[model samples]
Target: PTAPVAAAAAALCVLAVSPGQAWAASADGPDGPAAYETAEGAKPVKGTAGSGDGPEISPGTYTDSIGRGEKKYYHVDLDAKSSAFISAVAAPEPGSRVKGVGEGLKIRLETVDGSECDGGTEPQFSAEGAAYPVADYATRLIGADDECQKAGAYLFSVEREGPETSDPGRWPLELRYMSEPGLKGGPRLLPGSPDSDEEPGDDETPAPVTSGEKRQAHGGTGFNDAGALAKGVWRDRIKPGETRFYRVPVDWGQRLNASVELGSANSPGEYPPTIYDGFGITAYNPARGRFEDDPFVSYTPDESAQAAVYTPTVDYTSRFDYSTNTPCLAGWHYLAVTVSPQLGKFFKSTAPLTLRVDVTGTAKAGPKYAGDAHAAGFGVSDEDKEQAEKGQNAAEGERSDSLRIVAYVGIGAGVVLILGLAVWTLTARRRAEALPGAPGTPGALGGPAGPGGQAGPDGGSGTV
Candidate 1:
C-alpha cells in the first residue's frame, strides 16, 4: 500500500480504538441524546449494605449505582466546628420506564449511634411517569440541634424504590460531600424582613422580561453540568422522557422568576385530545434540596404549555423558615424542566423550548462565614455572573475541560505517530528501489529468471 494510504489507515485505527474519541463523535451526532456528565475526578465507590461499614467519602464528588429495594451506605468524617452536607442525585437511564409519583430515591444522614441528623429528604418522581434526575441532601448543621452535632463519623445512606412493575435497571447516582465553615460569630438567626415594603397587590402578575433577543443555550443532563443563565431569554430543545438543568446565580435579596414555554405540537386526532400534566418545571436550592414543587400544566398537542415558578427573595434568615424553602440560600439555584416519556408516543421529534428568567431586587451583602463560602458552592461571585452571561456551563468546572483537552492531545499524538511511521516506510522503500539487487528489478532478488521466465506484474518472480 502507498505510504499515504497506510498512514490514513493507522490514524483511523487509532480513533476507532479510542473510547473517548468514539464517545465524543457519537454524542455530537444529530441523533444522539445528551447523557449525564458526572463530576470530574468523581471516584467510583461501592456503597455497603450496612451503615458505617461502607467506604469513607471525603469532601468531593463520587458516583455509584443503586438498585430498587436496596440500600447503599457510605461514611464521612467531619469536624464539630464546621457544618457538613451530603447530597445524592439519582438519574435513570434515558428511555427507562418509571412508575411515577412514589418511585424515587431517599437519602439520610446519621451518627454511628443511629441518631438521625436531619429529617432526611426523599425526592420522588412526580406524576409525569417519566424518569428524570432527582436530588436531595442530608446535612449535619453546626448548632441546629443537640443530636448528631459532634461529628466524628457519620453514615450517609441512599435507598431506591419503585413500583413492582417498573424497570429494574440500576439508577446512576452522583454524590457530593460539602463542608460549610462555622460562622465568624457562631450560628445566629437573622431577623426576617420583607424584601419590599410594597408587595404586589392580589390579582397582579409581574411582567416577564421579553425585550432581549433570545440566545442559544443547551442545558445539561444533570446538576454537575447544568448550563448557566442570567436574566435573559434562552432557547433550547428537549425530547420526550428528557430533563434539562440550568442554574441561575441568585445573590442575597434577589428574587428569581422563571418560566418555560413548550412549542405547539401536532395533534394526534384523538377524541377529547389527551391532556397530560407531565410537563413542568421544578426548582432546587444550592444544596440540591427541593424547595419548590413542580407547577405542572395540562398539556395538549394542539396548544402550547407554559409553567412558571417564582422564588422568594434570598436571605440568610430564609434557611430558618420552614414554611417554604425556596429562598434558603444565595447561590446557584437550579431549574429542572422535564417532558414526560409518554409524550414520545405522540411526538417522535424533539420539541422547541423557550426559557425566560428574571432576577429582581438589588443584591445585598451576604452573611459572614469563618471560611470561604464560595469554595463550598454557597455564594455567588463575579466570575459566576460572567459565566452565565456568556452562556457557559457553570458546573462543567475546569477539571472536565482539562480532561477533554488531554483526550484531544492523545488523538493528535496518534496521528503524528502514524505520519512518522509512514515517512520511515516510504524512505526505506525508495532506498531499496535504488539498490542494484532490488526485489522488483530484472536481475535482482526475487526477480524473474533469464529470458524464458515470465515476470510478475512488478518485475518480481512469478507465482505460477
Candidate 2:
C-alpha cells in the first residue's frame, strides 16, 4: 500500500480503539443519587480568610468545599464595560440532614473598598428537610447609577449556614463566573413596567401538551449539567431527598411555562397516612438567580401532586424593571424539581416525575452585544435547541458509550475496506503485467504488435 494510505489506515485504527478509553473514563460505579458535576477542567482553589488576601479567580468555573458556618472568600478582576455574575451551588451528601427553611448557602459580591455590588442571595432547603443542591448568584451590572460600575478588583464571599443539629460535614461547592458584554451603545428601548395583576390561577394556566410521546430526560444535579428540555412532556424517576435540574432555551420575546407532576407512591397503604410537603418546583434565570419563590404542593402517598411556574416574555430591558427582572435574560432558563425526604418514611421506591414544558411567542432578534455573548455562555445556539429536542443531558464527562462504540466500529470497518480495495487493485495490475501479452508486452492492446498479419499466443491480433 502507498505510504499515505497506510498512514490513513493507521490513524483510523487509532481512532477506532480510542473510544474504549472514553468508555472507561465515562463509566461510573453503581448508581446512587446523582451528584453535582463540577465544570470540566474546573480549577480547584481554596478560599481565604480575608477578601483582600484571597486567590484571584478568573471568569470560569471552580470547585471548593465549605463547612458549616464557615465563610470563604475569593477575588476576581473586572472591567467597567461588562457585567459580571458569580453563581455558587452547595451540594450536601445525599442522606445528610438539613433544616427545613434556614439551612443552605449564601453568596455575595463586593468591591475591594467594601462597597456592596449587589445584595447577597441565600437559597435554602424547603420545609421538607430534603438535602439537595441549593444555588444562587450575585451580580455587578453596569447601569446609570450602580455600585461597582468602575470596577478593578472584586471579592466573592460564600458562606454555609445551618443549625447545630444539621450535618457538620463539609459540602462540595461549584462556582461559576460569567461576564455579560455591555450593549454596543445605550439602551435600545426603555424597560417594561411591572404588571400589577396577580398570578393566574390554575384554571387560567396554559394546558400541558398531551399529544406527543413522552421523552426520557434525566436531569442534572446542578445548573452546569442540567439536562436540555424542549416544549414537550419529559419523564424521569426521582428518589426521596433528590433534586433534579433541567434547562430550556428561551429566546427573546419568548415566554416559558413549566410544571412537574409527581405520581402516587407505590404501596401507599404500607405506611402512615400523614401528609407531607410532597414536591417542589423552582425556576432560575440564566445566571442561576432564583426568579420566583419555589412552589410546593401537599403530597400524600395515596395521590399524585403537581406544581407549575409561568414567566413573562424575555426582554433585555427587563433587568431594569424590578418586577420582571428575573426572566429578563434570553438564554437557557433552569427548572429544579425536588421530592421530600419525608416520602422515604412512607415509600420504599422512587417516585415517577413528569415535566411539561411549553415555550410560546415568536423568537425575536436579541440586542447587539459589544462582545461575544455565546463565549460567555449567555446566548442560545442551534446546537442548544437540538439538544433540547433530543433531551440530551449536559453532565460533564458523561456520554453514550454504546453510540461511540458503534461509531468507532463503523469508521474502522470503512478504513479497512478502502485499504483492501487499494491492495486488490495494485495486486491485479502487477499480475496482469506479468501475464503473456499483457500491457508492455508486444501483443498488448497499446503495445507494439507481433509479426505482421499474425495473432499472438494470448489471442491478441498482430499488426493486421
Candidate 3:
C-alpha cells in the first residue's frame, strides 16, 4: 500500500485502541454521586454508596454530587483513640424554595448500631436569603463522655434538613473527613476539648453597656440604622431578621478584632431537643460592601447545654490597597449581627447578643500621592475613585479549566498521531527491503524469479 494509506491504517489502529485505554483508565475514576477514595479500585470497590449498607469510606476528601431527598451514607471505622471530623460543602441551588421554614443540610455521626455519637446538628441559614456554596461541618471527639466510642463501623450520613421541596437540583457535594488519632496510651485531654478544665478568665473586660447604662438606643430598627457601637464590649438584643449595624471609625494602620456572644434566655429543658437557632456576624467595609475573603462567623446553638452563650470572634487587618480593598479598608466599617429565628424554637423571641470591638495599632495616614486630595475615603485609592466616578464594576476572572483539559487532550492526540505515522513508515520500509530482488535477493523486481521460483515475490504470491 501507499505510504499515505499505510499511515491512515496505523492511525485507525491507534484510534481504535485509544478509546479502550481511555475507558480502562476511567472505569473506576472519581466521577460518581458520592465521590471518595477507596483501598481497592480494580476489584472495583464502590466510591458512591447512599444506603445504610453503603460502602466503607476512609478518612479523606471526596468530591461528590447529590440531589434533593437523596441520602448518601459512608461508614468510617474508628477506634477508641481516634476522633472524627466530617464536613460537606455544596452550593445552594438557585430558585429553590422552602415549604415553610428552610433548613440547611444535616450531617450526623452515628455508631454501628445507629446510635448518634455527636448530637447530629444541621447547618443554619436564613430561609429567605442565604448564599450558596456554604461550608457545613460537624465534629465528634471520642472521650469519656461519648458512650458510643466502640471500635467498629460508624456511619456518616448527609441529607437535606427539611422536606425535599425546600431545595432541589443535583448540587455538587464535597465531603471531607479527618480522623485524628489520639495520643497513644491512657486518657488524654485535647487542648480544645470540651471537657478541658480551663475556666473562663476571671479578669474579663467589662462590657460597654453594662445592662445598666442606658444604651444610646440607636434603636437600630434595621440594618441601615444599625446602632453606632463604639470600640468597646457592648450588649444588645436582636429579633428575628432584625439586623443591628454598628459602624466603628477604623483609621488606617489599625487592626480590629470583634466578637459577638449569643445568650440563651431559656433553660435547658425549656425548648424541644430539635429546636435550634443561628446567629450570623458579618463585617462590611466602610462602604457597607462585602470584602472578598472576609471572615463570616456563624454559630448555631442546639439543646446540648454547656452555657447559655456562643461567642465567635472575627479579626481583620486595616491595610490600604486598591486591590482586595474590602477586608483591608478603614473608616466607618460596619458590623452587622442578624438572627435567623426558628419559628417554634427557643430563639423565637428576642435573643440577647453581646458585641465587643477592640482596636489596636497606631493610626497612620495613607500614602501621599498626586491624586491623594481626591481620594474617595480612608482606604479607597485614586484609581478606585476614578472607577467609582465612572460607575464601573470590577471585571470577573475567567474560568478556563475545561479549555485547558481540552488542550491537553489535543496535545496527547497529536503525539499519538506522530508515533503512529513513524511506526507505519518504518514498517513500510522494512517490508519493501525484504521484497524479492529488491537489492540482494535472487529474484528480479519486474520478473521475480528466485531459485525456488514458486511465487510472484519472496517465494510467495504478490497478494499481501
TM-score of each: 0.76, 0.80, 0.36
Model 2: lDDT equals 0.77
Candidate 2: Cα lDDT at 391: 71
Candidate 2 residue lDDT tens string, 1-464: 46766766776777667645532433442355666677778999999877768988888889999999999999899888887788898888877888768888878888888888754678887755677778888887777346788859888999898889998899999888888888887334334432323342222557776668899886877787788899989898887777889999988777778989988765556563755567788888888878756787888767778889877667776566565435367788999898877787655667789998998767877778888988787777886786688676653223544546676777878677777878887998989888986778655765654567566656666665
Q: lDDT (0-100) at residue 452 of candidate 3?
A: 55
Q: What is the alpha-carbon lDDT for the whole of candidate 1? A: 0.77
TM-score of 1: 0.76
Worst lDDT window (10 residues) for model 2? Answer: 194-203
Ranking by TM-score: 2, 1, 3
Displacement of the residue 288 alpha carbon in candidate 2, Å: 1.4
lDDT (tens digit, per residue) of candidate 3 on 46-74: 33444467767665556666676666787
What is each predicted model's overall lDDT from 0 to 1?
0.77, 0.77, 0.47
Off by over 4 Å in 1: 1-33, 189-205, 270-272, 325-327, 395-464
After TM-score superposition, what is the CA distance of residue 146 in candidate 1 from its true location, in Å?
4.5
